[model samples]
Target: MKIHDIPGFPNPLRVRVVLAAKGLLDKVDFVPVDLPGAEHKRPPFLAINPTGTVPVLELDDGTYISECTAITEYLDNLDGNPILTGKTALEKAMVHMMQKRAESELIDAIGIYFHHATPGLGEALQPYKHPEWEGRTYWGEMHREKALAGMHYFDSVLRKQPYIAGDFFSMADATVLGGLLFAFYAQIPVPSALTALLEWKERVDQLPAVIQASA
Candidate 1:
């Protein structure tokens, strides 16, 4: 399997963390996409993934998978260990629910601010080409504020449980980890009010898998 990814991008980090957690890093070849030159939008890359998103998974047979969640689910199904996703039926539901919330409330929110409000990259993103998100400048700011609130929400929840869904480390944790990392990278300071979340992040960061995947 070949994973088209970007070093400094958060979306690709999500898959990298999952692969690390599953101990499948060596099983897949990691290909770094050239983002600075808009290579993803060009011919060869687009032929593989019309969406032109990073972290695309290409099978040896020539099939391609885009979208972070789809790729994760595909990889998780490959092995019997469902710990990263969930084991029980209820666990699966909760994990998926929490993952969706994190994406909507935090990850996508931070992405908006990063891609739109930030200038150089914003101009390169070609937002004008997609009119649906034309006025996203203001929307990105709004989403950013909501993302901050969502961080506090997660922090408060972490105060009671060991992980996002519960005591078990699941996809929810991975999602939040990637999201928080992006937020911090984008200059969105971690709120001091969420002391528990801060501690939890420190613990998560110390894991060998997280360390290796990040490296």
Candidate 2:
């Protein structure tokens, strides 16, 4: 398998962390995609994923998978001993539920703010993501506030449990980690008052898989 992405990117980091957690990081080849150059928005890359997104997974037989959640599902289930996703019926539901919340309320929200409110990836990607729209900037700012509220919500959730979904570290935790990383790049600082969230992040940062992905 091969992953097409730019290194150190937020979404790519999410998948890379999944690969590390599944012990399959070394088994896959990583192809760099020039995100800042708008390479993904071109026809060649669009053929693989019409959404024109990065961190696309190419299977050996020539299947292309996009979206961090979908890619994670395939990788996690490959060995039959799924870890990042869930093992049981109820676990899967909870994991997916929280994962969706993580994406919508935090990561994706920050993405809108980052790409619209600010000069996101510079001039090359501007046509695809219009940075000049006054209305869009206002919309993006609204999402930034949504992201802030998301932080508090997650902090409350973490205060009551060990992980984002419950007792075990599941896909939701990984999504939260990725979301926090995105928040950093978006310049959306996590307030120090969210102790539960900060503490959970500290614990996750110490995981071997997270350390490996960071390296």
Candidate 2 — worst ten consecutive residues by lDDT sum? 125-134
- Candidate 2 lDDT: 0.93
Q: Which stretches of candidate 2 lie over 4 Å from their true place?
A: none
Q: What TM-score do all the candidates reach, one by one? A: 0.91, 0.98
lDDT of 1 by residue, 1-80 (tens): 98999865778878888888888889999888887667788889999898887889999999999988888888887877
lDDT of 2 at 172: 87
State candidate 2's TM-score.
0.98
lDDT of 2 by residue, 26-138 (tens): 99999999999999999999999999998999999999999999999999999899888889998999999999999999999999999888888898999988655769989
Q: Cα RMSDs of all predictions?
A: 2.1, 0.9
Query: Any idea how many clashes model 2 has?
Result: 0
